[model samples]
Structures are given as C-alpha cells and as structure tokens.
Target: MGSKLSYYMKILLGIIMSILLYGVVVYAQSDALGHEKWEYVLEDSGDILQIAIPVSAGLITLLKEDYKGTKSLALSYGTTLALSYTFKHITKLKRPEGRNRFDSFPSAHTSSAFSGASFLQRRYGWNYGWPAYLLATIVAVSRTEGPDGYHTVWDVLGGAAMGIGSTYLFTKPYENPKLEFGLSVNRSSRILTIRYIL
Candidate 1:
C-alpha cells in the first residue's frame, strides 16, 4: 500500500509540475508575443513540450516498471543536454530575437524534445514513437517560427540531430521477459533448447 501510494504521488507530482511549467511558459511570453491566437498556441505548446515530452517518457518507463529504460533515458537525455550546450557555447551563434546574447547554435527545447521522442521510440516501439516524434517536430518548428523565435533553421536542425544521435546511443528496444523450450531434429541429430528472454 505504501509503495502504491508513493507511485500515485509521483505521477500526481509530475502532472502538477507539467501544468505549472505550461502556465509559466504561456504567461512569460504572453506580453511579448503580440501575435495571433494560433501562434500563441503553437508557441505555448512547444514551450510546454520541452518539459512535457521528457516527463511523459520518464513517467511511462516508471508506469511500465522499466527501471532499465529509466536509466537509459537519463543517460540519453543527459548526453543530449551536454552536447547541445557544448555546441551552443562553441558556436556562440546569435539568437533570432537579437537580444545581443550569442549562445543559440542549437535550440535546447528542440534538442530535449527530440531526445525524449527518440528515447520513447527506440526504447518502446512505433506505437509510442510516432506521436512523440510528431510532438518533437512541433517543438522544432516552435523554435524557428513565431514572432519571438529563438533559433534559426540550422539551429533547429542541429538540435534535432543531437537529440536523435544521443538517444540512439543509449536507448534500446524494450522486450518482455519470456521463457521457452524448443526441440529440433536434423535427421540423425536431435537438439533441445531452452531460451529465456529478459
């Protein structure tokens, strides 16, 4: 019962955090956007996704009792962030907003989103991959589109490549545990095999 309660609390906390993050994103940009409703919505979605995609991926692993997958996600995500920031500092490309700050070689939001999406797809299957990929793609566009765009097309592309590349390095396909026995006969020889998949 205690374990179950803790599980529920974790999920609840994740939901709360995601909501707060979304609210902060929308409110933070509301004053500066001055754009159409659709643009605002698009920007809001993308901003929220930076946190949402990874949180959802992490939660899914926990929900499915995939401790190994959780570990893989941590490594993949950490590597993606490290690489993105490393490139940003190395390139020092100017942002689209012309804020005079130059650390926008890669879009963090886009990289994180793609990392999460790739993690889900590679660890699980296409059933989860397609939707995550779709959301990640939106995130990539969000960095490039809108009046207050933060990155150029090259930055978004670089971020996406980093994300996919890092995730592919750490994540593996998830498989269910199975035990089976098989018998084979090859003319004069007979073989029995026991297989356990973990």
Candidate 2:
C-alpha cells in the first residue's frame, strides 16, 4: 500500500514540476516564434503519427495474444482522452492567435501521442519505447510550430503531464505463470524422462 501511494505521489509531483517548468520557460522567453523555425516534410504528419501509435499498439497486442496489455492500453488511452477534453472544455482557453476559442487548454495530439508512448515503454521496454518517445516529442513540438501553431508550450506541457500520469495510473505489469521443468530417472528400467508443467 505504501509503495502504491508513493508511486501516485511521484506522478503528482511530476505533473506539478512539469507545469512549473513550463511557467519558467514562458517567463524566460519573450519570442513567440520559438518553434516556428522547424518546418519539414513531416511537420504536417504529426496528427497521423500520434494516432498511429495506439493503433499499432492495439494491432500488435492482438497479434501477440496480449489481452491484458490491450486492455490496459485501451483504458489508459481512453482515460487520457477524456481528461484532456474535459479540461479543455472547463478551461475554455483559446489557441495561439485566437485560432480556436475552445478545446485548447490541453493539446490532445500531444496527450494522445505521449499516452501511447508511455504505454509502449511501460509494457515493452526501451527497444520499442525510445522510438515511440522520440515520435511523441516530435508531435508535441509540431503542435507549437509555424504561424498556424495550435498550442502554446503550457498547453503541451499540460497534455504531456496528463498523458504520463494517466498511463502510470492505469497500466500494470503483466505476470505470466512460470514453467516448471523436471527430470526423473527410474532405476528398475534405467530410463530417463523429462517432465514439464505449466
């Protein structure tokens, strides 16, 4: 119980720190075009990439017969999406330059992307995880790039916090029963046999 409590406390602390860090970044920089310089062929593909993470995870889970992983991913993704939209509506914050007046407090793309990345990392390990994280970072950065930027740094930070927090809250380690192996020898017939139990 104490460990669980500590885990949640750490997640909360992380969220608070991220928000504070975002505040510092906002205060330290006066330039509104900080992220505008990054323009490339993949810039417009952020949304597609973000959505692909979960879809790919789901497909892989299904193919690999990972029912628990699939369920955990679904729960985490759904909860993150719900929380993000709820905050967006409640805050009613406008996008940069008043492009959109509602649903702008949290960047949904960043949240979703991060949620998928977190899920992959938590379940699979670093090999599959690091690339997902890198992609998620790209999605977050893309949200704030160019003259038509949709989200501010604060919004992206909030989304990231929500994504990481949600995944940590919902996903659990999967445990599989260990296989038992044994060897038996019969003296009468001098026969050897191997036994395996699942």
Candidate 3:
C-alpha cells in the first residue's frame, strides 16, 4: 500500500510540474522575438546530432545489456518526436522566416535533445544531463539563427517540458511505494540518482 501511495504522489508531482512549466512557456512567448535581430545560418548539423547521437547512445546502452535503459531512451525519444510534430501541426503558428507554414509554438529539435538528455539523466546520472541540456540549448539557438524565427523562447521551454514530462509520466509506476525519497542531479558529472525508502 505504501508503494502505491508513493506512486500516486510521484505522478501528482509530475503533473504539477508539467502545469507550472506550461505556464512559464505561455508567459515567455511575448518577448521572444524582441531580444535579437534575426539572421540566417543553415547549419544542417542539427539533423546529424539529432539522429546520430540518440541512436548511438541507445545502441551503446543496448550493447551493454541494459534493456531497461534502452527502452527508456527509445520511449523518451519517440514520444518527444511525436509530441513535437503533432504540436507543430496543430498550432500551425508559422515560422518567423515564413519558409514553413507550421506552428512555431514548440521546437522539435530542442524537444528531441531534451528527451535524449532526460533519458540519460534518468538512467546514467546528471553527468550526462548537463551536456545534453547544453546541446539542446545550442539546438534552440540554431533555430533562431536560421532567420526562420521558427521558434520563440516559449517554444523551446515547451519542448523541454514535453521532453521531461513525458518521461516522468510514462516511466514512473502508476502507483508509487510509500516512504522517503531523494533525487539528485550532478551538473558536471552527468549523473542522476533517485533513492527511496522501500
């Protein structure tokens, strides 16, 4: 019964965080474009990073015989991609450059990178999360540099929220165990650890 309660609490907390993150994303949209003058840089490198890194990571994890880790990574990446594409289509907000008539409400590349980062954090530790997030940040910046205004700051935030939220919601048990819990993120070491009373 305690485990069940813990599960519920974890889910509840995740929900709350999702809501707050969403709120922040919504609030950030107003000034996203005002901060900088737009420029164009077609650094198609994002595609390579997006596909190659995750696949290689996932493959490495699998090679190491970590099925759970592989599954978790796959799920996070797949869900983020689905969410990003769906959101783009649904919102149809249009990029700043007007090249694509899609919604600029959320950034797919950022979300993908975030999902990858979130998965690494959950399985490996914070040591991986920081670099992943830093890479995600670069991906977000790249979008802005492309003159497409393809994304606003809010969009990047939203992408991050989706990336992390989806993982939290899906990876956690439907019900939790009862007891004390702890969470940690190692910025430099790229490690994440969660300890709970069983």
Candidate 4:
C-alpha cells in the first residue's frame, strides 16, 4: 500500500506539472490579464516553490521514517546554499534590474528549487524527478522573467548545476518495498508467498 500510494502521488505531481506547463505556454501567448498581474503570479509562485520543493522532499522522507534520507537532504541543501552564496560573494555581479549591489551571480531561488528536484530524482527515481525538474525550471525562468526579472540565463543555469551537483554528492537511491507475490515448489510441497520490506 505504501509503495502504491507513493507511485500514485508521483503521478499526481506529474499531472499537476503538465497543467502548469500548459498554463505557461497558453499564458505567454496572451496578455489578457496584463503583464504585471501575470508576472506577479509567476514571481510569487517561484518564491513559494523555491522553499516548498525541498520541504516537500523532506516531508516524504520523514513520512517514510527515512532519517538517513532526511539528514542527507539537509546536507545537500545546505551545501547548495553555501556554494551559491559563496559564489555570490566572490563574483559580486549585479542583477538585471541593477537593484542589488552584488548578489546575483547564481540565482539562489533556482538553486533551492533544483536541489529538491535533483534530490528526489537521485534518491527516488525519474517517476518523482521529472515533474520536480519541470517545476524547478519554472522557478529558474521566473527569476529571469518579467519587467523586474532578477537574474540572467547564466545565473539560473549556474544555480541549477550547483543544486544538482550538491544533491548527487550526498543522496542515494531509495528502494521501494512494494508488495509482491511469489510461488515456490519443492520436492515435497508447493507454497505461495508474499514479500515486502519495512
């Protein structure tokens, strides 16, 4: 039941991601809601996703009682942030809007979002990763979108690479303990068995 439920949830996330992708394609074609309003919506959604993705990944591990996974997630995410900020300090690049003095080399929001996406994929599978990657891509685009967009293409790409690299450093694949049925026959007897892992 647990494995089944997890697979179902992954499917749902994939569905939701498809809808979001469709929305982006559709909305980009029309300015019916005006640029400011739609741009704000994208910006706000990106802000939420930057944190929400990693938090959601953590919750999944916690629900499965995977303390090791939780610890690894923290380590990976912390490293991503540390690396991102370190680059920010070292490069001291200005934002597209020139709003900040020097904190725009690698988009932290993109990094955070990608950390979750890559962690889930690397630790679980593509069934969990594909949708996450799509959502993270949206976060990256949002950072470079709108009249007040913050980062550049290079910034988002660098952030994405940083986040993924960190997760790969610490995360491991998770084996699903799905219930399976088996039949065995011996010289004296035949038997049916059910198997699963805790």
Q: Which candidate is the best by lDDT?
A: 4
Q: Count the backbone clashes (under 3 Å) in each candidate.
A: 0, 0, 21, 0
Candidates sorted on TM-score, descending: 4, 1, 2, 3
| Candidate models: Cα lDDT each | 0.82, 0.72, 0.60, 0.85
Candidate 3 residue runs with Cα over 4 Å from true position: 1-42, 172-198
On TM-score, the candidate that comes out on top is 4
Q: For every model shown, what is its TM-score relative to the native structure?
A: 0.76, 0.70, 0.60, 0.78
Worst 10 residues of 4 by lDDT: 29-38
Q: Is candidate 1 or candidate 2 better by lDDT?
A: 1
- Give the range where candidate 3 is weakest over 10 consecutive residues by summed lDDT: 35-44
Worst 10 residues of 2 by lDDT: 34-43
RMSD of each: 6.7, 10.6, 15.5, 4.4
lDDT, model 1, position 101:
86
118-149 per-residue lDDT for model 1 (tens digits)? 99889877767766787788788878875578
Clashing pairs in 4: none
lDDT of 3 by residue, 71-113 (tens): 7777777888888889888887777766756678688877876
- At residue 14, candidate 4 shows an lDDT of 69
Q: Candidate 2 has which clashing residue pairs, if any?
A: none
Give lDDT tens digits, candidate 2, residues 110-135.
Answer: 99989988887787655556667776
Q: Candidate 4 at residue 85, lDDT?
A: 97
